[model samples]
Target: MDETTYKFLMGASAFVIAILGLMLAGTTILPEVGLEKLRKARSILIPSYFVLALLSLVCCLTGYDRRIEPASTLLVASFQALLFTMSMLVFIRPNEVRWKTVFRQAGVITVAGLVLFVSFFRFTDYYSCFFYSGVVAYVLQLIIYTRKFMLAYRKTVQEVEDYYDDDEENRLVWVKCGFFSALAVGIMALSILFFPVLYKYFVPLYVVFYSFMVMWFVNYYRRMKFAIPVIAAMPQEADVCAIPETVLAKTDGVAAEEAVAVAEEAVAVKEEKSGAEHLLKERLQKYIDEKEYCRKDVPSGIVADSFGMSKAFFRQYMKDSYGMDFRPWRKELRLREASRLFAGHPEYTIEEVSEMVGYNNSSNFNRDFKRMMGMTPKCFCKQFQ
Candidate 1:
């Protein structure tokens, strides 16, 4: 690419990147339950892009088109580090983002990256060595980030599975796609530094890719904000699934009340508690026996309401009694019923059996079945035959 053409494209890239920053700015109101950190991350991100645009314009004007200057090197390294760190903050331990620690870590890393960046700069003959070494370090950094992000992604998937029965919408798959796409873009961006022949192609591609990333993030955040309530109302201490009558009978009465009053109060409390527990248990058993879980995807809130229990309390109850979360428990029930259906109705297609077992998507049904049963639906059917 010629000097004039490269400069024009770089200028356009800067403008597009700045516009993308503004697009990110518009999503500032997307923070929802358990995701306050995303707002802070976005706050850092918007300014970072503006800084990127300024750097781009500066490099373009100075004819440091190949990015050989120390200033350009430092700025690019800092931007890449910021991107990686912010991504780690969002995905790894989202709620526990400590700005002080993050700043400190960034400071330490910046010093180290500067040292590596200038290792061969003083020796003009070894500039090639310096450039390739920097690329090696960038590749290593990406490898580390990818591994950590993948581990975090797996944990996030487990949490999503545990919390939502359907889980189709809440899986954070877009975030994973964005993360890997950023790494892929980073590789392409690095190539532009090595081979100026590719700069013209890459600069425009980077602008389009980043704009898509910003939009994807905004859409995902908006969906998350709507899917999860802003505040989960925790159940009060008095609110419980099944309070034991024995515990209620031992509570002290008011100072003015005599022993007889205390006894009478305890007896009334025990009767009320017992009656409520009996009714709820009967309803719960009926819910189970009638195979209500097989009808459709049921959220914990609905299940809790049917038992006249709070959502939080019901989740805890499931954890305590069943040693698993509601989704997994419900999944087991549906899968077992599916197995039975598969054995009895050899004529049923995998999709038909999946729908009968409350799985709206056959793909999810296949995935879950393979995960649980150690084989595909087709393979399982073959065993039955």
Candidate 2:
């Protein structure tokens, strides 16, 4: 590469970095999602970019001296290290991921990377091997998130045509950016190792990619208008690392909104489920009272059908509403009614009373009543007498 070309690239990158630093410092770069973490991230971003710009200028100043290349490499490595550290702060999930954990992990990565660079470049004269050592930890972190994103993407697409959900979809935004940024880093690192000449231009190029991805995440997340629920469960994947191109951007908002309404029947899932459960309880109670359904030899199907609900859902409703299974609860109600009949209508024979309550045989009724109520029917009646 010619000196003129190198100077031009470095000068351009420095100017761009300076502009981005000013934007970060002024907090004018973000869209206003009303999230405090991102605001705090912008606060940290100001100085990090300024330092990165300074480092780039220093590297450009010492470009002619091959003897000082190791120092330049170390400086660039330090900048990369700080880049990921700031990234960790920016994307740290308040509840799902801890800030201290990210800080400690970034610290360890920086230390380990510096140690490897020193050992390789100074001791063994292998300057190239020190490359990408700074990024290993953050890349691994992104790889983990990438896997999560792919799994989520696959699951979401299974039910729908695209990946735009209003509920918790915004949560995956940063992870998607992480996946792309990590891919760029991996490619750049590999290219520099295999083709040392690639480093001359690839540094500026990869920096451009990295900076755009970071800035996009910040602005995009801030504009992501939705409530963040608990991070949805990511489906398990074996060893898949396939990255599809730029998924979250091309989603059809009209189609997605329509699909969500159709998927959930034009109601918020929580609100719909809540309202349905409440109605189910009310209707079931009304059915039971009007028909004395519990006193009948009622099949679960009959009881559920009377309330116009599926048997399975009715059982779930019973458990959720009353904290017991449907059949046992019906039996308890029947036994109580039988006790009331025994006490009030003493002249009615046990067989007659049992038959009225839908019992086919008095002996079976007495036995079940004894088992549940701890007394025989006649004994129960005697006490009432």
User: Candidate 1, after superposition: displacement of residue 136 in Å?
Assistant: 3.9
Runs in model 2 lying further than 4 Å from the true structure: 28-34, 64-92, 120-178, 200-204, 210-218, 229-385
Which TM-score value belongs to model 2?
0.46
Per-residue CA lDDT of model 1 for 185-238, tens digit only, reads 677766666566877777776677678757755765554442343122222355
Worst 10-residue stretch by lDDT in candidate 2?
Answer: 159-168
* Off by more than 4 A, model 1: 64-78, 88-93, 112-133, 165-170, 226-281, 285-362, 366-385
Residue-level lDDT of model 2, residues 1-385, one tens digit each, is 4566666666667678887777556545443343455556566557767876776676566553444443445445444544543454344332333457656755775676667657665766554445445345445654665564466554443322111111123344454565556556645654454455665667676567547745655464443332221112243344221111222333455577666555554345456557767778788678657646434334565566666666666667778778987766766666777887888998878888777765645676787789988989888888766
Model 1 clash pairs are none
| lDDT on C-alpha atoms for all candidate structures | 0.67, 0.56
Clashing pairs for predicted structure model 2, backbone only: none
Error of 1 at 198 (Å): 2.4
